[model samples]
Target: MKQAVVGYKVQNLLNFLVENPQLKDEVIGISEPLAATQTEFVMRRRRSLQDEDAITVYLLGMEGTVAPLPLVSQVLQWQAENIKAFVHSHFPGDADLCGIIGRASQCLPPLRKALNATQVDKDEVLSLFIDHIDALESAKVPYPSYYSELLEMVLEDGFTSEVLHSKLFQDAAISIKEWGSPRQQQTFVAICSICPTATARMLLRYCSYDDLSPYVFDYFDQRSVGSMIEPHTYLTIRRRLEKSLSRISSEINVVFITDSSNGAVAANASGAADATFFSVRPFNKPVTLDTLFVLDAATISSFHQLRGGGVSYPLLCAEARECNSRRAASNEKRKTLPQGAVV
Candidate 1:
């Protein structure tokens, strides 16, 4: 029979994906059915299946590849769960209902609109959902998959897509609080993968640890002496930052002030103003001794200007005044540009 043949082919394909480790890594997408044998495919952990296009192509190559009835049931259950979560998070007070009811309730508004009803009370929908939920739960197959599709949905376009991420996955929110939060570092990188500009410019600026400060000072140090900053502090600051700012364009400027082996110092910027940080990648750009001003007076001046000299997030401010009084002695005129100001 056609049904038997299709079922056999589906089983074979699943076997092929589960058996070949390299193919699983590079091409095969679904591994949820293999969860009993492979812990790596577990939902709460694995991010996604790779090679989306290749998997689609491979599936198309099979002549009349038919998904088994069980697989069809699993897809319906997944859709049911998604609907349940969506309604519970948004509609309020209906969170306790069973999943099948939830899906029917979501469909009510459109159904009513089609039926020419002006206003449809959701309480009736919830009641209908509750009545059918028991039967639905008993009769259907459930998707043994992880939450990868929903997670991926929320992350794309910085979760700002007016149609997709915002409308459907609105209840699922992603937050990376600080550097030390467990899994925050991973979420941070994930955000960068989808929305690098926002991650570098806005998200990092808000974080406890970010590359903004060092990038500013390094850009400034081209005009000053390296001897001003202490060896240990400079290395620590340098270690914390990984020249990733060159990839993002931000108007915000960070002024750093660090304690030195000696007293504070200042930058002696040169005429021509040399360069700006954003707009162009500073690839092969000259490294500056301005790092020497880690805790120097000039950096402090900018911080003070940002927070009105009171304590606040120093690196988060857009603009601050530099104390160039120390540079007053330099007769060699230098045009100091506001970092990212030109771009």
Candidate 2:
């Protein structure tokens, strides 16, 4: 009768029989239950026999979140065997088994020390475990979802409390400083709900005195401006505005003058000259010879006729005369004042 290998098992068992020619005549009968429990049963059988030959036990897709080495040690103790080789299966996607095994080894220091293990013992155990995992991965074993969740929890909680807070503040300060400018700093501070402070000083570096004033004003707009004023406040705004205006006007010049033609007239015998004639149109009415300039009664009569309609000429002439008088007074006062003195 042909030897039977259990559970539609690998045909390699036939090759095994041929290699050990002495075993050819021995009937090979395999059981599904025995194959299923092979690792546990073999460990027990080996201990009972006190076998000299090393036995390999493969734990395929074992469950539970405890580190593998300690768990494997417990299982070996339950079978009352000093395990020659203990291996755990891996899935196809398990790429970092070396790192995982290194971490697992840390949890098994007692087991390693109890085993009186040398470097060679450690290496042999790791090699055996890795080879089993490699074979399982090649066979496309699936990893349990609980293992993934357990790994995520470990990673998430790994940071020390001190390191976590340090990183938090470091990232926050850097983010605030990179946002740019004093106005932006204030805006960001307001948004972040942070009080102004030296640690947050970068928020204020690009801010000018004037830049803060309006916000200060609006901040205390309900309160008096005097209460909001500081030594830096007024100077900063004044300097900023002066600098801004200087930059704007650097390429252009502006001059202002009043109509001199209507203001100057020959004095009469009574020391009262005839009403000075000034063109009455818009304030910016173009200065042209045809825009009838009236002096004395004759000019006034001609201006009335030229107007024909629209706005009273006598009223316009009176307003223009008042304007001219005020302008002359202002110029006389300016002449009296010292140059470069503030008005």
Candidate 3:
């Protein structure tokens, strides 16, 4: 009769043998929730049994998600004891497991030590896992029932790839390209890619010249060099536009602004400031003054007379500049009283 041989992808090797008699000399399993010491034991065991027969090999789980550290540790530890070798899987595309494995690798020194120990041997453990998974897939073994769910979790939570590719982000990018300046577009893209959705929104909503200047300034002071303006800066600029309009005009029935890219910045002014002036300052550029003008219901109605009813940034900039020039000339005229001499 063949010697009863039980193989496990992970050890506590003796425990597995004690639990199942049929698995005796035939049982093979892999480790789970891999840690440092366990991985060494596995590697060692496999090396010692290189010449052994009647040993079965087992590869547990799918590729990418395979627990490597403990498995490697176990193999290393058992090499001295002479255990047979078995293949293992690594689910590389699985983000959750990859993150877990990454974190584990960082936090556990023992695992790293074991991996370094094999440096002289030039064994590529990760490559081995990948090869094993490929071989298993080619062999047409049935996948586990939970495989899809595990993959989904990894994609959604472990990595941000799904969120970055989401429709919301794509739409925002498209809008920015269409209406925002190049700087604005780049800033928006960076925010969408790097920030959590809620945080990004908050940054846009709060950081502005009028509402939170001090806070915004402080934030910039602390950021990494060359980082783009935070969302809060955009929000502050929007609020400043709203407040400036309120102070300058009374006919402005409503005032609102949006990212043009994000379609998110929106506000309405009523009551005394029913008619309003709105302006947008593209990132890294001075505000366009020629475009500023009073907006009223009648003005909006007149705008509708044109092919497209939306307000135009270029038109607003022109009007704002003209208005400022007239104001400055008026101030000059007032100061002309001194030309007579002293009084």
Question: Where in model 1 is the C-alpha error above 4 Å?
Answer: 1-18, 21-74, 90-125, 133-343
Instruction: Return the number of clashes found in candidate 3.
Output: 75
Assess the local accuracy of residue 288 in candidate 1 as a C-alpha lDDT between 0 and 100: 29
The alpha-carbon RMSD values of the candidates against the true structure, listed in the order shown, are 29.6, 50.6, 37.0
Decoy 2 TM-score against native: 0.14
Task: Pick out the ten consecutive residues of candidate 1 with the lowest summed lDDT.
Answer: 55-64
Assess candidate 1 and give its TM-score to the true structure: 0.17
Whole-structure CA lDDT of model 1: 0.24
Give the TM-score of each candidate: 0.17, 0.14, 0.19
> Comparing candidate 2 with candidate 3, which one achieves the higher TM-score?
3
Candidate 2 least-lDDT 10 residues: 58-67
Tens-digit lDDT track for model 3 on 238-329?
A: 34434544444322121222212111112122121111211121111111122111121111111111122232222322332333344345
Best by TM-score: 3
Model 1, C-alpha of 151: deviation from truth (Å) = 20
lDDT string, candidate 1, 23-110, tens digits: 5444323323222222221111112223222111000000001111222222233334344344434343434323333345454564
Give the per-residue Cα lDDT of candidate 3 at 236.
45
The CA root-mean-square deviation of candidate 2, after full C-alpha superposition on the true structure, stands at: 50.6
Q: Higher TM-score: candidate 1 or 3?
A: 3
**lDDT digits (tens) for residues 215-277 of candidate 2:** 211111101111111323223322333343453332211100012223212211122221222
